[model samples]
Target: MNDVIRAPLAFRNQHEILNMHHLIIGAGPAAVTAAEHLRKLDPNCRITMLAAEGVPPYSRMALPYFLVGDIEPEGCYLRKREGHFEAQGIDVIYGRASSLDTVAKTVTLLGGDMLNYDKLLIATGSTATRPPIDGIDLDKVYNCWSLADAHRIIESTNEGSRVVLMGAGFIGCIILEALANRKVDLTVIEMEERMVSRMTNAPMGDMIKAWCEGKGIRVMTSTQVTSLADDAGVLKVSTAAGDTLDADVVICATGVRANTHWLDGSGINMDAGIVVDDCMATSAPDVYAAGDVAQGRDLSTGDYEVQAIQPTAVEHGKLAARNMINGNATPRGGTINMNVLDTVGLISTSFGLWMGVEGGETAEFSRPDRFEYLNLQFKDDVLVGASSLGMTQHVGVLRGLIQTGAPLGKWKDILLVQPNRINEAYLASAQSQHAALAAA
Candidate 1:
């Protein structure tokens, strides 16, 4: 951490004397993970979790599965057993944080209730972004973010229901299968030139778009939704291309923004998200941030960035919790920017700097006819990034090679020539590194 005055201790624990009022904001994966870890660290710590949603702490990612009828509402919960939080001595309060007073060590809720804490964790995750479109606030327009949104989508969406999805980003693509499962008259609008333009390369994105279209989805790329109009109960979607489409429901899968507006005057540093050190500690003393709301380190770039994936959120929460009790004991090395999307039956994945860093070399192999593509990015002798489509077997190895930063040495040259030899390269590089470490 930073040089600052250490807060006074309320009591002494087995390891150290410390204040035990560990309060966590948000009820997503990060919040739940931190709360559980906090309990395991300090059984007697006064742990309270503030939830913006009225329902139980559940996985937002599971909302798509719920929409597909693969799982019920209960399956979306972080803790399934009755009184799980209570049994673990964790208090879950439903409220949105309105303001924060770092000096007073208190957080004011939207309902005007002030909660004081000795150690606070701001895991307040991201909120779904709503684009500036006319009639976007209409009754049928919903962002598939919360459980409530899922329920509304389930109720409104029926067989052959005309659903216009506004955005072909990761979140939008995730719910594509569920929407397809409903067999609705689907149309996906993307402002980019191809699907998942942010995550994958143009070729891979185009392949995904083609696959979706093959599945009977109307995919419109390089298109913009100009406005929306209410046609009685139907939604009239107007695009910048001067096209009007009738939709029963408009699912706004635009994107998400960090939930850090409340901390504006709180003096906490923020850049894209609440900036945090390796210890997950923010600029404020005794306050930490994690998950989508925290701008942590990216392993590939060594720069602070907000990784809104569930895996990163879990890691952030765990590390933040450990550091909270042990005083910045566990420093987060960095998080690999990765995303795996299952668009209908086709799978696409990207790891680390998938777009390839400046001065980096890239090896590509595309077989569009067979719906297969692979791109490997290398910097020096290290595998820094990779992207693959319809190649599920190498997903784990690709992620491992990028994350481990194993020196490929000669394998780098070999991979450049034969990109499909990723498995061999991973094994050779990892084994060499392991052998070297063992000898050391």
Candidate 2:
């Protein structure tokens, strides 16, 4: 339905002039998705995708479902149409890109082999954070970032086993549900003051902690594990608060750092991750980065942010492929920083500036007894952000309102008085827009 992507630079298709050799330095969904789109644009181009792990490409997000025994490993594969990569003439190499040079247009693998390319995609994703705790490398300690980690976790953890998880952030909370489902004795240690601190507001995070504690979980906030060591047949965890606990397994879900270590000497711009333009192009010529490794434009704030969510990764992958194929392709506008988390039985969501911007207004209502809450952020008359707990249906409207920058007019006043009328406000606003369009 749309044509002419119109990139910021002059461009040509790879197959138009010659068969372009494209080298991709990752095999996650983002990398695989890019390779597929490139194949569609140039059927005869040379495409090589490198996988840091030995196993087939799988999703780290699906690892939790696997831990809960909901699906097999194959279910985590991005595209399961057999031989998908081979069918597209894309070579899947198994190794890491140890070194790269933009001027030389080459990527040196760990084994000293080199691959020259016309375009390079850095989609190496991220790695689990190994906290600087004593005995953190013990056999029973693990992180749930890769399929290999999932395998180790599911194998070691069992029914009625003692499990101590460090960090109650998003990734940590996600695995909390799965570990609980396995009937393990779970205790969560969070350095933050509340759960999901980065995503939910203070009130909502406290509410979630209370809910989890009520659900028979031992949630310890404002706490840290000072050291961990094996004691006899169990692991002993020492806390910064001078407390000790024992566990059959210790999990470090502290968070993640982007896989940008290889770019230290590559002269690529980076803040939290690889800084890329709207075309997903890095500072280096013909070099691009996407997925969790990329720090791209944030639509809501108009700043660069790492939106590591799956949808953002898939979109980034496609957009990067467009620029790699034809430099004239349209640049990506940006991606919203959003998160919808399902922790055990409770659902929470945060979108845009959930922390509320300065000089802005907020309308929030909470029923702690009923496990329901809603907070709306407004800049002048326009919705800028929102956060909610146990309000699944309202999430869509909240995102819509914030994204569209809708002028609620009198509806804003109504919502401030009666927060429950959010659905009605959305409907009325939509109807008004439709009527205005019809009149036009």
Q: Which lDDT tens digits does candidate 2 get at residues 60-159?
A: 8888899999999999987788877766777776777788888999888776777789999999898889888799998899998988889999999998
Off by over 4 Å in 2: 1-17, 430-440
Tens-digit lDDT string for candidate 1 (1-440): 11111223332233233547888989899999999999898777878888787788999888889999999999999889987887877777777888999999999887577888889999999989899878999988999998998999999999999999999999999999999999999999999989988788889988998899999999999998999998788789999888999999999998999999999899999999999999999999999999999999998889999989999999899889999999997785788889888899888988998899889999999999888999999899888999999988857888778776788999999999999999988888875565543332
Q: What is the C-alpha RMSD of each candidate to the true structure, in Å?
A: 5.2, 6.3
| Model 1, total clashes | 0
lDDT of all the models against the reference? Answer: 0.88, 0.85
- TM values, all candidates: 0.92, 0.91
* Model 1 segments more than 4 A misplaced: 1-19, 431-440
Task: Name the top lDDT candidate.
Answer: 1
Query: For this target, which candidate reaches the highest TM-score against the unseen true structure?
Result: 1
Residue-level error in angstroms, candidate 2, position 23: 1.9
Instruction: Mark the 10 consecutive residues where model 1 has the least summed lDDT.
Output: 1-10
* Residue 93, model 1: Cα distance from true site in angstroms: 2.1
